[model samples]
Structure formats: structure tokens, C-alpha cells
Target: MSKSVLVVLSEYGYWAEELVGPLEALDEAGYRVDFATPTGKRPVPIGVSLDPEYVDPPLGRSVTTAEMADKGRRLDASSRLDDPINLAAWLPDRPYRSEPDFLRRQEEYFRALAAELSKADRYDALLIVGGSGPIVDLANNGRLHELILHFYRTGKPIAAECYGVACLAFARDQENRRSIIDGKHVTGHCIEYDYKDGTGFEGTDFVIGPPPYPLEYILRDATGPDGAYIGNFGRETSVIVDYPFITGRSTPDSRLTGDKLVEVLDKGLRTWGFVPRTGVVAPEPAAAGDR
Candidate 1:
């Protein structure tokens, strides 16, 4: 069976390059990829390529626009910014009340995730792409926790980038165990970037948490003091791995993040029941003394 992958996104929009880039990579690699959003609607890019804050006025903006236009023009041209997916199309939604927008949105994503999980036998991996929207849609949602737990329990390769890491904090095992990422080496959008401008507009408009929301601050609390990890020194850091979980800080790491994700997925596939028919294979033990 062709390897199938589920790509989860935040419905709001921003940082289109982050998810689009990795998605194109996966598509090119011949993987079957599907999209799901908090509301099961077509996800939108969080900001315009030309948004002043989105990129440096001159260099960053033009460069980013060209890159996204070249890579994600389909996503760009798609008119339905709020396109909806049938969250009920997935099984998990059957158990939830569907009135509150937030609850329904959360259930849509979790149900999509559950649907993906139900296909474990047919799929090879799952990738969760992070963006500004996840802070609002993905984190702190019970549905997200349900989906994360499903992936964690199945021991599949899970990749999260940028705000994508927030979902990990929500996942707990059957015993109510926290996700493995809670105490593992991981990084995401740096706190410096959050406060470098000394303005909280970013958080106010994009993210999920109480007042004074910050990814780093939440991670610290989630880790519960002395968790093994380090991050955000002078320069930016992107991409972090803690066993089954793979995370990336932001867009710069998208390519490498996708590559590493494929690696992990390949490993999982091999561990399950896949065997490569071609490519270099470990030589069967030669004569006992051939070494």
C-alpha cells in the first residue's frame, strides 16, 4: 500500500510556508497526504506574504513571497479561506457535543486525527505542521489530546513544527501519562522572537493560552522544572527530536524537518512490516570468519 500521511494544521492562518513547504516535499516523495484543520475547513495562511510584520519590509517579504508563490501557489489560489471539512466525517466526533465553536472546531481536528489513527494499518506515518493558528486551535483542546494520545499509543512517527509542538503538551496516555516530549529535548519559536519586539500583538492575536501566552513559558510549565532541554540562545534554533516526537522551531527548518520525518517514518515502517526490495541491504552474515 502507498504510504499515507495526515497533515494537521491550524485554521486561522499565518506562516503558510511552514506547512506548505513540508507538504510539497511529502507530496513529491510520493506519499499520500491529507489536510485537516481545527474546524475541518480549508486552512488559510495566517498572514499575507506582503504583510509588513510577516517579513522584513524589503528583503524578507519579497523572498518569502517568491518562495511561497513558487511552492504553495495552489494553497494561495484556493479561494475558500474558510473551506470546511466534515469533522463528523471522522469517527471521534460522534462522542462530542457540536455547539460551541471552539468545541466543535477541536472535535473536528481530533476526529480527523482519530480517523487517521484508525487507518494505522494502512498508513505509514503522521506529520503535524505548526503555525500561528495552532496556538488558537490546536493547543489546550481536549480533542487534540485525544488525537495525540492515539498516535502516542500506536508508537508512530509524529512530526510537529513551530506551534505544532503545543499539541504534545495536550497528549496524555491511558494512565493519564504526559507525552514523551514533556521531558525531552525540544524547541520551537524562541521566546526572544516573541519578546524581541517587546510587543505582545503576536500572542494576543495568535496562540492558545491564558494572558501572557508564550510557547517557551508554557513549555517550561509543561516540563515541570528540570526537564532535560535547552533553547534560544543568541541565534535561532529549529527542529528538535525526543524519541517518537519530532519538532521544528519555524520555517527555516522546514526542509530538514521533512527529511528527518521521512527518516523516522521509514524506520517505523521497517519495524512494522515493510522491507525494502531494492537499495543497499545489510549483507546477510557472510562466512562466520569472513570478517
Candidate 2:
């Protein structure tokens, strides 16, 4: 049977390639994908992401190819994004303890909440698409964290790219207050790739000098002593699959991230990037051209 995946996007703005690359790979593998956003609003790609000649402020070169730009533009113009699942509406609200009938109400609320989270069972995996936008909303979203927790607890594959990896670092259980990725090997945007200036969210006027927080440092601290963070900054690509958690370093690793997720689903591949202590080497995905 074909697997289904839930793809979460940021409402601020997303990189076109970050979404398109994985989507193309998923499409080729025949997996059904459902898109969701923090609000009911349809997500939009950063303008630079859809411009073939647009030069990256940090890299000082045009990163998007003509073909990818065309694909991103087409996807953005489609009506498919019109009816995305509204995370705010679909996810349960957090009830306060000070409210009336706190204990009984909380019990009843949790029971319903569990049922709502179980909707994730329909998806074989959850992918968080990356861009500057995720830095604004997706990184610290409680609703998104609950959703990630649902997938993590069920042993479903969870993939994240670029800044989207921040979501994994923050998804924690209230009981332990530990991040979901507390002990999982993962990769994300490296320090070397960070922008020096002009970091801003779409649909807003404010522009920050750099990302509000350094993702690489956050990942390093979140993983703790047992788990390692692999930057692989200058490498062709970096995609790590440590069981349920799959992480990609940056935009270039997007397609490979999707491929590895498919491997985890189809071939029972358990680990990659870091050396496994079990001495059982994980199989690598088929080679493909760089994105």
C-alpha cells in the first residue's frame, strides 16, 4: 500500500526548493501528501525562492535554477493550497488548571485530545518544511509540538529540513520536559550557512540582521551528550535517519531527506550519518544528482 505523509509549512514564508524538492521525490514514490499551516491561511513561498536570477544575500549568487523556479511558481499558483488543514482549528487548545472543574475537565479534555491526536495515525510520516518562515512560527508552536509528539510516540518517521529542524529540537513532553530529539542523532542548518543580514519574514516589514537564534547551536544543545549533531557543512549533502527522526542539513539535502524517509518506511532502514553502536550498518539510498 502507498504511504501517506503530513507536510507542515510555515505561514511566514518557505523556500520554494525546500518544499518542491521533497515533494517531487514523494510524488515519484507515489506517496499521498497533506499540507498544513499554523493558521488556515495558505502558505506562500519567499519571493526570492521563485526567482531564478535572485541572488542569495548570504551566498552572493543565484541559487535557484530556472526549472525549480518554474515548478515553485506553478505550485504556488495552484488551488491545492487553498484548503490546507488549519492547525489552530484542528489541534486541541490547552486548558488551564485554574479553571472550574480543573481535574475532571482536564481528564475529559485529555481523553478528547488523545482522540484528536490519533488522527496522525492516518499518516505514515510527518515532514516539516524549512525556510526563514519556520523560524517565526513553526519553531516554537505548541500545537506543532503536540503534533510532533503524536508522531514520535507512535514511532512514525519525522523528517525536518533547514530551520524546520528547530521544531524537533523544541518538541518536548510536559512530564520530562525533554526535547523529542534529546537523544537522537540529527542534522540541520549549519553555522557556516547562516545569513549575515537581511533575514526577515514575508508579509512583514521588519528585517533582522541574522536569524533570531542560531539553529546549529540549538541543535547541538538539544541533542545533549549522548546524541550528536552533524553539520557536514561543506559536504555535498547531509541526511540522517536515526529511527523515527530523519533530519536534513539544508536545502541541498531536501530530496535526499525524502528518499531516506521512504527507505525508513520501505526497507526498515534504521540509522545513517553517524556510526551505530549496534555494528549493523544502515543501507544507503540510491545515488542521485545533487539538487
Candidate 3:
């Protein structure tokens, strides 16, 4: 049977390669891919992501390849994105605590969620493509959290890159409401790669501030005590495969992230990248004295 993947995209804007990379790999592998959006709108690439001449502030070079730019444009114009699964319509909503009959409604909501999660059976894995847009709608999305949990609970791989990985950190257990990634190894956009200015989502006009939060800081806190967040600072690429979770640091790791996910599915790949307590250490914070 051909494998199927459920790919979630942010409606505001997704990094061009973040979606294109894995998409090409998945297509080459002959996998059936489906799309979903928070509100059923077709996802567009963040403008700069498709511009080959845009120099990345951190990398100090153009990250977008001309080929990638063309691919992104053609894909955006294609009809494949015409109709995405409407997350709001497809998933169950949680009732507010102050709503009438809160207890009954909450229970019903959960019951409905359980039924909705059953749809994960149609997929072999989950991929959340990333960009600044995810901050607007995909992260902290309760409906999406439930979907991520479903794939996780069923032993299926869940891959996320850049800001999309934030969803994994927030996809908590309903009862504990704690991050599922608390004890898992993962990677995401590190502080060093965060833009110093002009962080914005395509869906909104608030376009001149840095990302509201540094993903590296959140990943560090989320994977505390037992787990580790590997940023691989100064490395050209960072993609961690810790069984059910496959995480990529940013756009540079996009294609590799997809290739790793393919290995996880095709060859039973279990663990890759940093081994804790084996002389491996996460990047350290500088002391005030060091400055």
C-alpha cells in the first residue's frame, strides 16, 4: 500500500522550501499527500521565501535558489491548493469553562475529538510545514494539537520545521496539559536564526517586529529535565529524528528533514542526531562576565 501523509500548512504564509522540500521527496517516494489549513484558505509562500535575491539576515547569503523560487511560484499557482481540509469544520471545539453545562459540553467535545482523531488512520504520518505564519494560526491551535496527539498516540511519525514545531511543544495531554515533547529530543529555529526585525505574518499587517518569542528558548524549556533540544549552532543543517518526532531547525534543513522522514517511514529509522550524556552538549548561554 502506498503511504499517505497529512500535511498541515499555515494559511498566512509558509516558507517556500519548507513545503516544497518534503513535498518533492514525498512525491518521489510515491506517497499520497493531503492538505489542511486552520481555516481552509489556500496557503501562500511568504514573499521573501520565494525571492532568490533576498539575503537571509543570519546566513548572510540568499537562501532561496532560483529553482526553488520557480518551484514555489508554480506550486502556488497550481490548483492543488484550491481546496484544503478546513480544520475548524473538521475538528471539534472545546467549550469554554463558563459556558452553560460546562461539564457535559466538555465531555461531549472530547468525545467528538476522539472521533475526529480517528481520521489519522488514513495517514501514516503528519508533517507541519513552517514559517512565520504558523505563529498566527497553527501554534497553540487546540484542534491541531489534538490531531498531532492522535498521530503520536498511534505510533506514527510527526515532522515539523521552524515555527511549525511550536505546535509539538504545545500539543499537550488534555488531563496534564503538559507538552508531549517534554521528554523527547527535537530541533527547531534557534535564537541565532531569529530575525532581529521585520518578523511578520502574511495574513496580518503587523510586520516590523521580531518573532514574538524565540523558538530555541521555548524548545529548551519544553524539553527539560530528561529530554534535550538540539540547535546544532553553526551547523549548516539540523534535523533530529527521535522516533515519532522528526524536527528540522529551519529552511536550510528542509530537504534533509524530508529525507529523514522518508527514512523513518521506509527503513524503520528510530534515532538520529545528538545523543545525550555522550559528551554532547547544547549551546550554552554566555555569562555576563564573558561579555
Candidate 4:
């Protein structure tokens, strides 16, 4: 049977390469992918990501090749992303205790939540595409947290790249109030790659100077004492796969993240990047042409 993946995108603006890299790998692996957004709106790639000649502000160089830029534009214009599932509408709404129907509504909400979470059975894995956009929306979304928790509880592979990894850091069990990644090894956008200024978001007038929060610090704290956060800055691409949780450091790690997720689903591979009790040995870098 062909595996299916549920891919969530940020409404503001997703990095073209981040979405395309994993998606291309998934497609090559014969996986069916579905797209979803917080409000059901079709997500768009950051305009600059489609320009092969556009220099990344932080990197001070053109990271997107012409071929990759073309591919990204094609995917953005494809019908596949035309109508994404509205995650907010699909998931149950939270009820306030102060409401008159608090008791009854809370019961109803739980029932709906259970029903919605059961839908995870249809997917072999879940992926949250990353970009600065995710920092604005996907990171702290309650609905996204519930979705991640559902996948976690069901033992389905959960993959995230770049800033999308923030969601994993913040996804915690309601009862214990502990991060789902509390004791899991992972990687995300390290401090070294963070843009110094000119952080922009779609559908907003403000262009922030710096990211709202430092992902490295958040990931370090969220992983707790038992868990490890591997930055792998300026080294080989960083993609960590510790069972159900798979995380990628940044744009360069996107394809590897997808490849590892495929390995987890197809070959039953359980561990990569960092292993507990044993020290980490960095894997040989991918071939130059592979990027």
C-alpha cells in the first residue's frame, strides 16, 4: 500500500525549497501528500524564494538554484495546493470555563476532538513545512499542537523542518504540561542561521528586525535535561530521526528530513542523528549534485 502524508503549511509564507524538497522526496517514494492550512487558505511560497537570483539576506548569497526555483514556482501554481483542508474548521474548538454552556460544550468539544484525531489513522506520517512563516503561525497554534499530540500518541512519524520544528517544541501533553519532545533528540534552525533583521510575514504590515524567539534556546529548553538538541551548525545537513519525531535544522536539511521520514516508514528505521547513551557520529554529507 502506498503511504499517505498530511502536510501542514503556514498561511503567512513558506519557504519554497523547504516545502519542495520534502515533497519531491515523498513523491519519488510513491507517497500521496495532502495539504492543510490553519484557516483552510491555500498557502503561498515566499515571493523571494521563487527567484533563483535572489540573494538570501542572512547568507549573503544565492542559495536557490534556477532549477529549484522553477520547481518551486510550478508547485506553487499547481492545483494540488488549490484547496487545503482548513485545520481550524476541522478540529474542535476550545470551550471557556466561564461560558454558561461550559460543561456541555466541553463534553461536546472532547467528543469532536476525539473524532478529528482519529483521522490520523488515514496518514502514515505528518509533516509541517517550514519557513519564517511557521514562526508567525504554526509555532504556537493550539490546533497544530493537538494534531501533533494525536500523531505522537498513535506512533505515527511526525516530521518538521526549519521553523516548523518550533511546533514540536511547544507541543505538550495537557495533563503533564510537558513538551512532547521533552525527552527526544531533535534538530532545528540554529542561532547561526537566524536572520539579523528584515523578517517579514505575509498578510501583515510589519517587518520585524529579528525572530520573535530564538529557536535554538527554545529547542534546548523544550528537550529537557534527558533530551539533546543538535545544532550541527556549519557542518553537514542536520536531520534527526528518533522514532516518531523527525526534525531538520533548516532549508539545507529539508530533503534529508524527508528521506529519513521515508526510511522510518518504509524500512522501519528508528534512530538517526543523535542516539541516547551513545555519542553522535555525523553521517557523511550528501553528494554535491544531490542538493
The prediction achieving the highest lDDT against the true structure is: 3
lDDT of each: 0.57, 0.87, 0.88, 0.88
Task: TM-score for candidate 1, please give it.
Answer: 0.69
lDDT of 4: 0.88
TM-score: which is higher, 2 or 3?
3
**Candidate 4 lDDT trough over 10 residues, lowest sum:** 281-290
Cα lDDT tens digits, model 2, 1-291, are 899999999989999889998898889989999999998789999988889888877667887899989999999999877878999888776678899888888788778779889887999999999999999999999899999999998889999999999999999998898988877788999988898998878889878998989999999999887787888765668888888999998777887888888888888998877676432223433374356
Residue 19 lDDT (model 1):
72
Which structure is stronger by TM-score: 1 or 4?
4
- Of 1 and 3, the candidate ranking higher by lDDT: 3
Residue pairs in clash, model 2: none
Instruction: Give TM-scores for every candidate, taking all chains together and pairing residue i with residue i.
Output: 0.69, 0.93, 0.94, 0.95
Tens-place lDDT per residue, model 1, 1-291, is 557877777666646677776776687778887666665767666555324345532223332556455555567676533454433345354233544676667657555665565754455566777665676667766555666666667776787777677778666663556655665556666565453332211224533323246777666666554343334333333555555777676666666567667766655422111112221122322221111
- Report the number of backbone clashes for model 2: 0
TM-score of 2: 0.93
Candidate 4: TM-score?
0.95
What is candidate 3's lDDT per residue for 142-227, written digit by digit as tens?
89998998898889999999999999999998788778888789999998898998887786788866799889989988987788
Q: Which 10 residues in a row give candidate 3 its minimum summed lDDT? A: 282-291
- Candidate 2, which segments miss by more than 4 Å at Cα? 96-105, 277-289
